[model samples]
Target: MNGRLLTGYVLRRLGQALVVLWGAITLSFLIVQLTPGDPARLMVMGGEGGDAGAANEEQLAQVRADMGLDQPVILQYLGYLGRVVTFDWGTAYSQQRQSVTDVIGQGIGSTLELGAVSLLLMTALGIVFALGSVLLPTAWLRSAFQGVTVIGIAVPSFVLAIALLQIFSFQLGWFPAFGADGLRSVLLPSITIALLGAGTLSQVFARSIREVSAEGYVEVARARGLSPAQVVLRHVLRNASLPVYTIVGMLVGGIVSGAAIIETIFGRPGIGNLYVEAVSARDFPLIQALIVLTGGIYVLVTLIVDLSYPLIDPRVVSPAARRTR
Candidate 1:
């Protein structure tokens, strides 16, 4: 809680983040090398369906040299680490003279927008579902709320996306089937992503609320003649919300990773769509960069959530901080 403790906690998390990043980079590099066939040849062939015999030895050798694939593996890895740190993600092998950064930039905005909208919807739906399950007067109403959450969790996102498209876009005609033209186009895909997270959070949150409601303080508040709403708002909500923060942080990473499938299903342009293209084309550089980008996002969100715990619940203490005392 003090300045010194906060500094040490932050430093520790940063160290852990660096380790995770290193692992992601190493994994990406290994994936490129372990794939069948020569990367240089693949690059020269211009990805899948290109004429394999069209590129001669000279072109293959040049591609290898240009990619630093001619160097020793250890040296190449070291150089790659340096490039990643410097944000020089190299060129897209499948695209003519386009940098990997530029290729990613083209779709990053769409992904971010989708992620943001989905996150908000996830939060709102989760809170509503959690509160309804716990606070609704009728037992049947509570069961219905719980049933919705179960369905949301059980259904595969891709299946749900297709079903939504069929009903909303094809039959009802309330929204577009696909594309990222306007806010309307965003609605279906965002809902597809949000439902999964909301379902998960609602279950976790409802459980937390039940546990918090039984605490002695809550009993005391209710004993003081405060109404149900007053007791819940004043005594139960804040403590119950602590677990929700952690769950929400984890959901952020899931949202990012899930974007690929959801984007592909909805015919939306996003990092996920770009990732599929990169893989299909055997564009190692672009694929490597995207892997790191997603990994970094996961690590960053987790670190932020860890740091926020002390602010949310001042009673929280890191093991390191506790040991120091």
Candidate 2:
């Protein structure tokens, strides 16, 4: 790609990321605001409900004012957007007025650890499975890899989590069933999240590899006396990886969503677990912050994928393509 084309692509993707983040912020705010539950009531009741028939109007009003629930929705949303831009997520209602950032901070380490491990595992498994399906000598071996990919795609993360828990934790006692403590505790959940990603990614990746193999460049590379492995690895794999990168971008969102369920299932203390509690208690600020954080992450990952494309294969975003645009 021309330098100008790469620069233009980065700028374009940044603008799009901003749009996605703003949309996520707005939607999350609306969902929390428009939902039927009242955070003020939950607050006054100390995260639980009491005799709703016995509460006085004055008490209700105080709670609403205290939590800024009395403000107009538009004003609240604007103010929220402002605070988020300033990195002020405010306090968590369900956590007794603790800073939402701090609350998230406490668990972010665990989440990052889990996320990192999950990503590595997913990439490893996806490539191995995809390559095996494409290059394995036996049809049975290829079919087995393809079969497992299908199962991975078909099964939900929570269901897989439960099954793994029963088999590895409960039956074999090979790993802990729940909690986020040490490396061993992280293994099962990471695998659970990875499997979810690997399943979808492997199928797409395998197809991409197969398609790239048929491209003229691969034939040219082989004609130039390059070995089969060299033709596949240096030529085919690099070109084929564009789609896989897109899948990796999408997998971040899947991992985030799956982590929520997986975290709750495994009793791991992460942002996912906190999100569950915030939703259950109708903690507006916490919920909005988590949504923005997760959405922002997804957007950032996709942006990275978009930018990395030209670096990996300049032909994908050539000057000619930019000129046509």
Candidate 3:
């Protein structure tokens, strides 16, 4: 739990994440390659394959050669790994003029802008709701808050987004229906993203906190003249919160992957939109690249959360961390 130990633990976990990412990328490439699609034919549809039904064997072979598809899968994977380490993601086959890194880089930023802000919103609101549901003095207030949380959980993001658009954009004409521009544009989308996250997290955290509060440590703290707020903040909160932090990290990963629908509804130029297009056009390389990228993101977030564990509880320690401590 000491600073030195935490740092070492984080570093080790990062190394493991790297390995997991490599495996994910390799698997994604294998799946995409083995499946049927012709990026070259898709790119130059009218000129190359207009008369034909699809890319012929010769066309597929030529396309493969042009894109270095002739190289062994292992070799290609190694090359991809090397490029990824250097942040040099290859070019998209369809958008030959634009670099794949550039496209994904922009999309990642856009997605992050939406995801991070929404995450913050969700966590704060969820925690507040959890506190209200469990800690609030009045049963009626608790029931009302719980009802709202249930409603939030039931409403799907896209449906919510559309409804908000209708209410705020169509009816009120307050913000653009589909864009990530000023605060106006993000308002509805952010709300929709936060609602689902908060609804789920609040339910989880409220239950956790209630259980922790009833534990012996909480009773002991209360016995020792520590106020309810003090005990909850000092002992109960930390214990109940440790798991939530992990869930938060997983939620971040979930948001990154899960916002595709919301992003599509809002016409946000995020990775989700690209994912949709790639699937539609059967852009194997792009799809493979996205899969790898998303996996890497998930692994990275999970590692961060793992490293955060001991910090929240002084007792927990990993091997590298123990040595450092």
Best candidate per lDDT, number?
1
Give the runs in model 3 whose Cα sits over 4 Å from its true position: 1-12, 37-62, 86-88, 225-227, 318-325
Residue-by-residue lDDT tens digits, candidate 2, 1-325:
4777667777888899999998998887787576666656654454444554566778779766644578987777777677788878766867876888999899888888999899999999999999889878789999999999887888977799999999999999999988888999999999999998898899999999889899887889889998766777788887788889999999989888877898999999998998888877767778888999899889989998988888887865665766763
- Candidate models: Cα lDDT each: 0.87, 0.83, 0.75
Per-residue CA lDDT of model 1 for 1-325, tens digit only, reads 5777678777887898889888998999898678788887776575545787777899778767666789999988888788888988877876674898998898899999999999999999999999999889899999999989997799999899999999999999999998999999998999999998999999999999999999999999999999877887888998889889889988998898899999999899989998888888888888999999999888888888878877876656656545753
lDDT of 3 at 279: 69
Off by over 4 Å in 1: 46-48, 318-325
Judge candidate 2 against the unseen true structure and give its global Cα lDDT, from 0 to 1: 0.83
Estimate TM-scores for all models.
Answer: 0.93, 0.91, 0.84
Deviation in Å, model 2, residue 179 alpha carbon: 1.4
Per-candidate clashes come to 0, 0, 0
- Name the better of 1 and 3 by lDDT: 1
Native RMSD of candidate 3 (Å): 3.8
Name the lDDT value of residue 26 in candidate 2: 88
Q: Give the distance in Å from residue 208's predicted Cα in candidate 3 to where it truly belongs.
A: 1.7
* Cα lDDT tens digits for candidate 3, 1-325: 3678667666777788888887887787676466655445664443322443555778667756645667887776676667556766554654443676777877888887887788889999999998888766789999888878986778877778888889998999988898878777776777788887888888889889988899987898899998767877788887898767877877876687667888899888888888887666555656777888888778877887877777676666656535654
Q: On TM-score, who's better, 1 or 3? A: 1
